[model samples]
Target: MPSQEALSAQVGAVYTTSTGAPVAEPYAAQRVGLTGPLLLQDFHHIDLLAHFDRERIPERVVHAKGSGAHGVIKVTHDITDLTVASLFSKVGNEAPLTIRFSTVGGESGSADTARDPRGFAIKIKTDEGNLDWVFNNTPVFFIRDPAKFPHFIHTQKRDPQTHLKDADMFWDYLSQNPESIHQVMILFSDRGTPDGYYMHGYSGHTFKFVNKDGKFHYVQIHLRREGGAKSLDNDTAQRLAGENPDYATEQLFTEIEAGKFPTWNVFVQTMTAEQAESFRYNILDLTKVWPHKEFPLRPVGQIILNKNVQNYFAEIEQAAFSPSHLVPGIEPSADPVLQSRLFSYPDTHRHRLGVNYGQLPVNAPLAPVSNFQRDGAMAFNNQGFRPNYQSSLAPLQYKRKAYEDVKHEIWLGDANVDLSYVTELDFEQPRALYEKVFSDTDREHLIYNLSVHLGNVKSPIVKARQLSVFAAVSKDLGDRLAKAINHPSVEPLAVKPATEAIRYKLKAA
Candidate 1:
């Protein structure tokens, strides 16, 4: 390890202005007299204060509380046949990568142990370009409709008038959009409060992998930790939320610094377009998962977090990842929520980090950038002396297409404004999860967690509606939740059928 003095010398031993001009007396400000008011001409003193005032850029709206590390992604298997992404061109191939683990729907000061979905975003700097897999700890999400996202996130935030986390606000949204029941059940379970950043990751939205021949396959990415997923009970999680709010972030940094690197095996489940047509669930639905029994995981690579970031703010905080950041062979599926994110993520980055956010050292791609875009806020490298438009004098070379543009012929359908309505199909996975997968102990913990939270909701209507939703999934779960909360049992509501979207279309017409 280098000494502090040596590290300081690498940049500069003496303090200076943002423009690097040496300061004679950084401590003293120019003033009229010994005890007089400080003069505005003291640029050194004024500059220091000014820079400190604007020190922080806007924090992320979602995933604001985060911890990250530098690492390497090494391909462990040959997946060249699946896609032409250079990162998996051959076995043992490696690329520098960064991983950020965060809690969704939380402020920068929010507790790490809060019962919420965790954001597991990874950026792999491959030779072709940067490839980011913005994923979640859960395999599925709450809602599939794109428009429901902002409304859903608002429910997770504090109430405007009350300025507090409102149980009514949360449950009201969930109950109204019963399609969210799958994730709601998962959230009320032990998995909601993960033990630490050491959790399995999944690409909740299905993506596409185009082969060299332009034939594409719908893909779901997974990251399984070397050790299986670990979780905390409701009591332990709540206790930790109060006792150690930064537990997960601190644990990740400390473990990495101590040379105890965490590793996750990367896998992908692929389905051809023909197979997707006959799949049990709509492949583009974010609220569903492709069962492993039908589509098993194929090993691709290993992600090892071997290095802790030197500066959290510079390296990790400024880092941005998006599912839209893809190389040639990787493409996004037409998942509605994902289509919205393809625009939203980069837009958020531009708002938070300026239009030239890509120019930042942390977010910059390794590939040499040659483009017409120039001159925005903080445009340090403006492609100096080059024409902003195409000119015969200074021509730029263009790379040929690696393969033909493969059209998704199977996706051809009547184009219209579509809305996914709640249906029995939406509840199938959560039902299976509760009835088949969860153990007796898991069920007890889940019921206890849900009861404690729901018991706080003051509205009888919200409670009844949510109970009905739960009953639609499993009678045992609904009855247990009602018993735990000392509420009367309610009849299960009939789920809207699959034709509900058509009904919506007819209503609109």
Candidate 2:
């Protein structure tokens, strides 16, 4: 292992300014004879104070609390037939990677054991470029509509006037948008508070893997912890949240530093466009999952976290990952949330990490970048001496398409949008998840967890509405939740079921 001061060029160094001008003293400011007002001529003192005042960047609006580590991803299977992504070019090919695990809807200081969906974001520095899989720990999410995301996130945060985490705000959103029920069930389950960063991961939205033959398959990415998903009981998670707020974050870094590296296996479930068209659920819906029975998980690679980051602020905090960071042969689906993220993520990075964020060491691509873009804040490399526009004298090179004549997806419909309303089918998967997927103990604990959280909600109408949503999933679950909270159930408002999408398409036919 390297020494803690390995990065330092000199064992004992003189203090320096931001631009490296040697500083004689930084402890005491240059004042008028040490008793009068400070001298404005002292550049080093002024610079130190100014930089300290603006040291921290704005926190991420979501997934604010996070832990990160460096790792390697080794391809374990030949998936060239599925996609031309260079990382999967051959079995045993290894690529350097960095992963950042975060809690959704929490501030930077929030507890690691908080009951929230974890963000499992990995950036692979491949020969082609950086391929980032910014995924979640759950197979599904709360809402499908992209426009509703801000509104949904607002509910997760504290109330505006009260400045407190409002249960009414949280439960009301879930109750109204029952599409969130599937994820709500998972969020309330043991999986919500994972034991550590090595737990399972999933791309809730469908994506595309296009092959050299111009064939494309809708894909769902998954990552299973080397041993399997490990989770904490609600009681334990809550207890640890108070006792050790940074439990998971601290553990991951400590384990890596101690050489007890954790690992996870990457897998994907692929469905052809035809299969997706005939599938039970809308393939683009983020709130549903493709049944593993029909589309089984195919092993792709292994991700091993073997190193801890040296500087949390420089490497981890400044690091950025986005689903839009595709190398090649991969593309975003028509999933509304994912399509929206392709824009929103880079937008946030610009605001948070500046327009030249990609030039940051942690976010920069390993592959050579040749673009007309130049000049921005923190412009580390301005493509020196190159024309910013196309010129015959120095024509920019372009890569040929690996595949041609592929069927391009064309999205067509009315400009007006409606929320993908709830249906009997909408509740079907969560019902199976509650009955078949979960063990009896898991079900009991889930009920208890939901009961405790929902019980805190002071509004009777909100509780009643949530119970109705649960009832739609299963009367047993609804009854169990109501009994646990000692509350009466109310009927949920009827919305068009998922079959409605098919019905509308059929009627158009």
Candidate 3:
């Protein structure tokens, strides 16, 4: 290998500090003598050491490990009737996008093939502003209530005492919270370990698309792989986890690098407010999914990941996404989880990235940004000489859209908040999934997967509670799970009491 000087000379490139100060002796540090202590005046050496020490930013509390790529979202279908967002103003409208695929409940060094939901976050640079769709590989989540979020995440993480993944701790929380059975079933299935990152992505949260007329439709977004979705069996996933932990990340990068761009067809299942009222399950329920039969998927467009990130740290790692990053016409629903996320996502970004995280190139919107925010740790764009408050002397022009002034929906009910109770309705979908959706082989795999993890749980009480929850979903599923785990018998349990009892009911006025 050529020396630094030789390489620089051959390339005719000057070596400089971050501030562009040319450095002649790039390799040597100034010192008192050949073997003496380093001089404090050696700013270059000190700067290098200081920068190296602060090189790492705070990793995300969740979805710490991820892979990302540059892409484009091409609007193939006209949805102007549905949403007034300019991202889909006309057919063939294409917007540049950045997508991050990640494993939830994992540290930065964790294996990519872990049996965890993949965070499918996309930042679409639209003409109006940046619209972020922070989705997941699965259509449903473990819990619907936002209050249970931290507790549920804690269960997924290491136990406080042991500082290790504790099966007893994991199942104890899930067993007590039976509403999680739906997502739990999906988690333990073959779908848990996806075939690399080539899996379907779902919004999970129901949103709204408001038109110019102020009419709105509740929507659920889905991203289906162009070919089809694929999954790996437990053995294969485990093998890859040990052999090559970065298998999924490598596959995505190499595929894009080879010019074999993976495409996902976007679709939405929409329902009117009137329809939502009569729907079997609450639209706000995160654990439940709208039946495709009732609300069919309408084609939207295609997302083609054509380019790979040149620098992971700068381009991908620094990129921030939030469910609240909505443009006009696209609005969040009343789902408690989604509602909570609107605040939490940006708050987490502020804490993890910085107060001025939005100023980062990857996160900054395509549209010109004019805001009152100024002066933080890293305020790249401080809007110099501009007043931070509204002023008649130099008034900022604000373009008000149709939806901006429209009062689309109104809530006239008493404020009532509590953890959602587990009812028979909670188990209906999971039962259907096991009985109707899963093939014989899929069922076998599901049973095996559940057995592998749940079997490790040493507490018989926790194991029995979870089995009962399964039995409630389906007697066959519960029996199979029990037999696989070598348990004696399985009995369906009544609806378990939630962490907190319903304190108040929503009474319509």
Candidate 4:
């Protein structure tokens, strides 16, 4: 290896301080004498140490470990009849894009092959502005109520006292909230571990596509892999998790680097206002999915990830996405989960990145940005000399347009607020999934997967409650799970250990 000075000279790169002052000898600290104490006024030495101390920012609460790549989204079909979003205005219309896929529940260094839902976030740089589609691999979510989100997440994470995953914590939340069954079913299925980043699909609750005529359609966006979706079995997923924790993460980068880019064929399922009114299930319910038979998907566009990022920290780590980052013609629906995210996404970005996170090159809109806001942490460009406020002296140009009436919803029954009702309706869809959607083999795996985790739940009451929830989905499923875990009925009695209960039951039989 060449010496620092020799390397810098050879590369023709000048050594400079963080603020761009010339530094002839950054390797050596200023000294009082040849063998005396070092001087404190060495700005370069102090700066280097200071920057190192603050090098790490806080990891995201979820979807922390991720990989991203540069890409393009090309409109493939006419969607102008549904949406005015310029990103899909014409058949040949194209936009520069960046996509980051991640696992949902793990910390920054967790295994990429963990059996968890994958995040499918994309940022499109359109002439109008930046539009971020922050979605997850699964169409439906675990819980629709925003109030249960933090509690549910805590259960999925390590227990506060033990600093280890608690099975009771996981099952208690789900059992108490039956609405989670639909998503829980999906999570435990083989689909939990996709073959690769692009092997699954995405949805951010349901949204709406409004045309120029103010005609609107409640829509669900699905990005299907060019090839049909595929998944890993439990044994295979666990094996990969141990052998190469960064398996999926590395595969994405390696493929893109080798010029073997991946693409997803985009599609949308639309519902008119009248259809929404008479729909079989509430369109706002994130716990349920719109059946394909009811509303078939329409081909719309394509997402092609062609280029890999040169710097992960600058492009991938610093990339911020929010469900609220919507362009005109694309708007959020009344889905409770989506409603909560519109605020929480941007708020987390402010905390994780900075107040001016949008200004970052990876996140900044392709369209020229001129706003009244100025002066916050990491303010790269302060809009230079122009008025920071709405001034009579020199007001900024405005492009005022009529607000889309299609985006508006008239609330019925009450105005203040209402508690989300939990009813038998929630179980209808999960039951259908178990009875109709999953094959016999798939059902066996689902039950086995649930048993593996539920068996670890120590509390009899919690375990019983969970089995009851499973039974609500299907009587046979519940009976099978109860036998699998050997969990005693929810009667007033001593709660035996799982293995002991199984042995005792067998002996009694």
Model 2, span 1-509: residue lDDT tens: 34376657556877789999887777878888859999999888888889899998999999999999999999999999999988888899998998999999889999999999999999999999999999999999988888889999999998999999999999998888888989999999998889977589999888889899989988999998987888999999989989999999889988887888899988999998777656777777788898888999999989999988877898889998999999678888877788899999999999999999999999988998998999978898899998899989999988976976354344211211355556677788898999999999999999999987999999888899999988888888988889899886555556565556643555357
Model 3 lDDT, residue 221, Cα = 99
After superposing candidate 4 on the true structure, give the runs of residues whose Cα lies further than 4 Å from its correct spot: 1-12, 21-26, 32-35, 411-420, 488-509
User: Which pairs in model 4 have colliding backbones?
Assistant: none
| TM-score for each model | 0.94, 0.95, 0.94, 0.90
Q: Relative to the true structure, how large is the alpha-carbon lDDT of every model?
A: 0.87, 0.86, 0.87, 0.82
Give, for candidate 4, the lowest lDDT window spanning 10 residues.
411-420
In candidate 2 the C-alpha lDDT for residue 7 amounts to: 53
Q: Residue 88 lDDT in model 2?
A: 86
Error of 2 at 200 (Å): 0.6
Model 4, TM vs. native? 0.90
Poorest 10 consecutive residues of model 2 by lDDT? 408-417
User: For model 1, how does the per-residue alpha-carbon lDDT over 5-110 read when each residue is reduced to its tens digit?
Assistant: 5577787467677788988777888898999999988888888899899998899999999999999999999888889887778899999998899998889989
Ranking 2 against 4 by TM-score, winner? 2
Best by TM-score: 2
